[model samples]
Target: MSTSEPVPDPSAVAAHSAPDAPRAHAGSAATPALRVRTLRLEDEIDLPAHLPRDLTAAWLRHGQGMVGIGTAWTCTTSGPDRFEDASARFRELAAAARIDDEVGTRGSGLIAFGSFSYSASSPRPSTLLVPRAILGVLDNDPFLTLVDVLDEQEDAPDAAGAAPTDWRDLFPSTPRAERTRVQIDPDHTPDEYQELVRRALGMIEEGRAQKIVLSESSTVHLEQAQPVATLLSRLAESYPTTWVYHLSDVIGATPEMLADTEHGRLFSRVLAGSRPVAEGSELAEQDRRAFRSDAKELAEHAFAIDSVTSRLADLTTEITASAEPFVLRLPGLEHLASDVAGELREGVTSLDVAGRLHPSAAVSGTPREAADAAIAELEVRDRGGYASPVGWMDAEGDGQWAIALRMAHLETPTRVRVQSGGGLVAGSDPVLEHAEALAKSRPVLRAIGRPED
Candidate 1:
């Protein structure tokens, strides 16, 4: 349970870095690489199957891996132009390099990992990072990229000589997974969050808003800092059905697919209107019927669907959405989830799609401007990276972005903050909404080593 490894000094690693032979690379942010070489291999290896689950600036969803352990280059930025700004930086790096890929897949080349704030105005950090090295498994082909940075070497070397022989050589054999547990402490008690929920409902009654997403955050104090790989492994095991992610300091397993684009095909998953699933409870017949027939749940889900399709209307074609939502069950909760997919019209990028669809009614609320106003007035602390778009982007502008839900921020060496929220519509009950927030939060608590009912 102890996170006591003596991490190597980064400067020592960078001193030996260089690009491969026959390639020269120069980026404004990174020292010029004499050459960049990538060792790649192909197999039928299931995406994440049997891979050493190490802590990297990475993500694993639906079996694909996006690893960012040793980054040679990184971009940390803020403001409304954050996404485009990061993309521009990647462009600068790409313009000056030659990449050697033994096997070419979507994730075979230049890679970046991102974690953005819920709002542009949020004071929290927003980042886009690129590893100096990558151990990626895309479509079952594994690759390791190494950059050799030589200030002044009389002899340039072959890519193979400059890089580790095996990807396994990149990371040390780590400790087996842990059983670290934490003491749970919340920013607001259940009753206090319920009061905030009631206040939001009152704002709706006053005709100030149609819906509000009220959330609660908890700071968990561990006996020691939880090991990153151990925590990530537990999350992946606990929520295999979701996208388990860790980028910089933000981490979680989120079920909501904000946007995904591949070869001009796009898909987004909308989740709203939730119900808790106890650890070992098979719903009786009546409980299932009410979830399907409840007017409040139905309305909340409808708003989510409409929010997605409407924003995507002008950007896509052959659009299709599920006529009705199906129940999506996770470890401790269930939600009304709908899938919306379409083909990109012509020049639409995944980032554009994510930007437009972000703060969807599912997370922010209806009539976004008003809902944001309510949250700004009600939420006492910044949301950091929770409930925002978090994922990766490639040189081709094709990628996957998911709503950063069920997330926690590793605040410091000994502290982490888990966050969760609920959508409130007319006829909403504060007590019920508070319970929903707790259910949303429980996943992170459990993942961080709290094994409890």
Candidate 2:
């Protein structure tokens, strides 16, 4: 990893003509850059769900260095129906903001989307922003620098040095539900579900792929409408340790990982939900102990650890993984957890690890390929961004990326697509699997102003 500090004021960097801007070098010295754009629903006339995916994939295939992208939209109710029409409006906003010119640009940047349900009591209009820059000192350290940028932008004078909105305000707080009621649809059945698990287990047994991560999604019809923000707040508060993240139109809440690229580090707290990482927290020791020892849960966690370690061993010179798995608890569920570390080999990059370890066993199954194929066949809808990797990376081969969960895709208030899935194993039950999918989606469902039935 590059040993450099982020520019205190990224905006202060001397601007060069668009054509003359210094290009980012993959492994060379160059300071990463940050730029933000403001977007509104009116800007997006009509957009497609695959636009963002296409843009991101194209960048990964052709662009160098780091990248970050974000989009936000507002849900609006039209007539008695026509929710899908509204969703299209939001998607258009996202497509309009794509960074097409950055394909040949040097360095790295990120693109993302954000939005809120139209019914949100605190209706803060949504905005989608994308930043691009050549990787340099800033590339080495992202989250801190990015967080700083967010802070700066949030604090920047808005015609008057008024606060745009703190992170807290962007995501509102709500009461926690002691027992989250979830509903699953038994009608939608995909035959590939069972085959995927079998294929994954077969691969592990065959040694073709030591470990594979597989994921599956199930659509849910809530009992009642619940506010998306309230749901997210409850999940975040319930599982404070998890790296809770929300995307405009994806599914599920993810709170287990954070990336610190500058130090050549990828910090993952591979436990699920709300389990304790320390001793003196809200959860009792006995509860934590029970969570830690559950065989089924531990098996789920061990797959993640082994997969991560195997990938790191191939990319780094040295590695250290926690010997024992622990418990991770969230508002609605709990999971086993562990941590893994390694020093990136001189020329190796996190992207390499990301490519190798993505779809970790936590998301997929024991063997990767079979599980992925199974998911593709079994799932009722194209996941688009739901389970795919989402995060930022820079030119220095530094940036953080995490599984895009607890997310939704907003076409409009009336027309939105929400997705959720679970890791299935031999012993996995359809009923339980369906329930788990619902539990995972709680975060995004709540964010979009949907009431939990």
Candidate 3:
């Protein structure tokens, strides 16, 4: 998909009228009306397995036009000491952009962007991008009309006449295995962990917040430095369903929401109690079936669904939630999942639901505020962009927000930083907890050219 020239700004063009604006119809329903139009892609395509190359090609061809791309993968961890707070500063930049004001008050239909993740310790981060401006840009471009065109080349024969292997090789080389090493938090005494959890629980009792996410860090000392891109690609390959993404200083590698509209076209999948659903050839039938039947794991997911559904109900009208958890299989792993839908009530917006449901039990823990504080004290490193909400929403309240996981931020190509951790509860074991963290980092390590073993 390519375009010839720079796409004109939608704002400069005749305003198409914001999605939230009331239409002036002579004979509409008497009740206060809400109108929503779906932005369905005329075509959908899966890019050739050679993602980076294809991405580069697409960029060269259509970089002039406003384009939207979604990259999903598992990423590598750059070790615990590599984490930073660049996301806090990114938030400041967004605030400076006045994105909230631009989209909320001014009704400019501005873009919304951010990151989401599962912990401060994920090796793999997922990301998604939906540029609202692309709608206007592609309005006149024939090459960009279908989503399928992007997928069209997936099965096409390679020019060299060799059968395509797994698509993972499309990217550059990842870091060597020798560089992967685990580190322990110097300050993480057992007493300290207990204290942190106690204080977090107290905060919940005090009503500062319901649940808070807490993290404990284990540092991994690398034998040598690795490239950030290599780690990102590994993560993408490992977890195809997860929205693997990397910003210069931010990462969003989890599956949350992407481009959800009132009219009910949601680009992303919500993982709750059942396994994530798999599409595409990357996942095998046996793997899919096993993922679908994992009940013990599903129980773990129910808390997440209950939390999200309850929060949505408090904020919206006409809410509907899935009764059973479904499978959501990404490239590297699978998740139990569900869906919640509802009409936005009066005086409510997407961000409203987001705020209410953030630090979800899936990422944080039950009794939110307490879990968060526990994570802060127990986890040696600050989360920065890890487990935060990241994505874009437009002025029309049509946008996506995904949990950032399976991701890393490039502090420098040779010195990228990443983090990954898991949810802990009363039954949690410290050793198993540590292993889970390591498993999560596999994606990032693979992205950066590190071996899983």
Candidate 4:
């Protein structure tokens, strides 16, 4: 049951935020050694699962791409000016790409898998990378992309170009333990998070800002470091409908769609307004109706929709949005979800759309700048790629960018920092929001083999 649907776009969502642009490669900028050529592989393969040795895995439904960064010419960038920096580098790299599209499709050529930090101020984990070798599975068939690092005199595809045949081993097997003990750091106690929430709500009351998204970061100590594949596979299995991604050390299943663009058609799904179906809460119709009618939830959802539509309106034409938000049910929660679709203007790259619509009210808040300032002043710790855009873009500018949410950064093998945040609006209760943050962490927490309490 492999569906090769085009990828779609997310929310805990700000792991690290950045306006992504720079890309650093192995060679000096003057003598760019990048020579990328993609071949349509005749063989079918499972992506992420059978990724080449040490390759990064990314998937959105059936369409996926894996890249072996090891020995692969790679480009990385970080800093306050990373977005513009990475963008310039990507343009240069894409210019160097030479594609032999035997079976022309979205993922058949040079592509980059990226994870931007949630903010420019926190630059530690921000990355925009181009893999030396890309294995993309599109429409059940895979395409093998080979990148060459050539000297001034050399010009030809690498020896492996004869056939698209590859059977590279997938490393990082799943962990065997049923569960590992997890120690949630005390610095991010619920009380601390609640206080932040209270402060934001107070600001809303005082006309400081209509809304602000407040978040907390919790570090979990795992008994051991599980292979990233283990958590990615778990996320894919447990949240089959969501986009599962792993780049560098940032990994998780994101439920919201930031935006996806294909052949000029664009799709953006914004999810906000959460209702937790606690450990044993009934999913009764009466409860459903009450939640749908809840004023606070509706307000939150409206802000997200407005934020998306307002931004998309500038970059697209014939935009249309669902009049009402439908209930998006995940494992332990439900969210008010609205979809906006439009026809993109000419020359608009998917990343361009992502940059314009990011930090939407769904993840950022009603007034984006105000929420950002609040987050910077309060959350203090680096988000490490939590809520930024995490997805892939290609040479042709077709791609899917999902908001980094429901994620954690693997600071080290033994430590993964889980991130969660909620929209703070007037009349919001801090206690429930605290619970919501905990609920958001459940995905990453569960991924690390945390035992059920």
TM-scores of all candidate predictions against the true structure: 0.86, 0.52, 0.53, 0.86
Residues 100-219, model 4: lDDT tens digits? 566677776667777777776565645556555566676676766766544435565444222233534322333333456677884566677788888888878988777788888877
Residues 247-297, candidate 3, lDDT per residue (tens digit)? 425543566552245433323245543222223334467866665665545
Q: What local lDDT score does residue 49 receive in model 2, on the 0 to 100 scale?
A: 13
- After best superposition, candidate 2 residue 22: deviation in angstroms? 18
* Residue range 1-453, candidate 2, lDDT tens digits: 111222111110012111111122222143223233221111211111111211111112111122222211122222212223323332343333323222322232333222222211212222222222111112222110121122233533122111233222222223222333334443245545545556655655565544444445444454343333334444444444443443434333465452334456555555432232332334567876776776656666666677677766766778777888755555566666677777777755444555556556666656666655555554445555555444443334554555666555543323345665666444445455555655665555554444445
lDDT per residue as tens, model 1, 1-453: 001110211221011222222223333334333345567664443434333333346678666675555444555656777666666665655555466666667776666677778887877656665555666776666777665433435445434333555655554343354555677888888778888888899999999878788778888877655666556666777787898887766888999999889889998999998888786564566887789788999998988898899999898987889988888878778788899989998867777788788789998888888998999899988887989989887656688899999988877756788899999999998888888888888777776775333
In order, the Cα lDDT scores of the candidates are 0.71, 0.41, 0.41, 0.69
If the candidates were sorted by their lDDT against the true structure, best first, what order would they fall in?
Answer: 1, 4, 3, 2
Error of 1 at 85 (Å): 1.9
Could you tell me the TM-score of candidate 2? 0.52
lDDT for position 405 in model 1: 92
Whichever of 1 and 2 has more lDDT, that candidate is 1
Candidate 4 displacement at residue 10 in angstroms: 25
State which candidate, 1 or 2, has the greater TM-score. 1
Model 2: lowest-lDDT 10 consecutive positions = 7-16
